[model samples]
Target: MSIHFTVSGLTRNLFHSLGLDNQRAPRPLNPEQSLLLECYLAGQIPESAWNDYVFETPELARHVNARRSQH
Candidate 1:
């Protein structure tokens, strides 16, 4: 048997493997960091929380960064 991942990159495939393809999967919002923006837009998170929540999970980091570049 074989598995077919519709995603087209190594990073993307890894993300799927990690179950972070969904928005609710608890992944980082941006790669470089969204500290100031998130704090201004929403609120601040604790230091430990930031460490826990912020990570370049799977395809999320690459995909999001790519899209941002287009704008």
Candidate 2:
């Protein structure tokens, strides 16, 4: 007999066995991060400062890049 599991099911099973199925997902941007992103998008924040901020938190970089792509 052959057994089949979908890719997602296999991933889920792996995570469950590793006790990582309950790990929290990435959160939405908080108000402060939103405001900073807005300012950066609006050209209010200098690129140097924005680069520094994004470098400090790669998650913020992802958020900013996603927002930029939407526009």
Candidate 3:
């Protein structure tokens, strides 16, 4: 007996197992948002300011929260 697995088939199976197959793609950050997030993650931005910015930017908040959860 022999078995074969195509790259596309393996990739699709992996994504499905990880629950990423149906999840909506993450939104890309704008230039300003990207800079702010980088600063925040690097501890250059204070928590107060980051909190305020996240409150006003739902997309950024989601990104931040996801990163936090990973750690």
lDDT of each: 0.49, 0.75, 0.80
Candidate 2 wrong stretches, greater than 4 Å: 1-26
lDDT of 3: 0.80
Which predicted model would earn the best lDDT? 3
Order of candidates by lDDT, top first? 3, 2, 1
- Which 10-residue window in model 3 sums to the lowest lDDT? 17-26
Clashing pairs in 3: none
lDDT of 3 at 67: 77
All candidates in order of TM-score, best leading? 2, 3, 1
| Most TM-score-accurate candidate | 2
Tens digits of per-residue lDDT, candidate 3, 1-71, equal 99999999999989867857545445889999999998999999999998899779857766776677779
**Model 3 lDDT, residue 28, Cα:** 89
Q: Write the per-residue lDDT of candidate 2 for residues 8-62, one digit (tens) a residue.
A: 9998889867856435443588888889988988899998998899777646766
Please report, as a residue range, the 10-residue window in candidate 2 with the lowest summed lDDT: 18-27
- The number of clashing residue pairs in each candidate reads 0, 0, 0
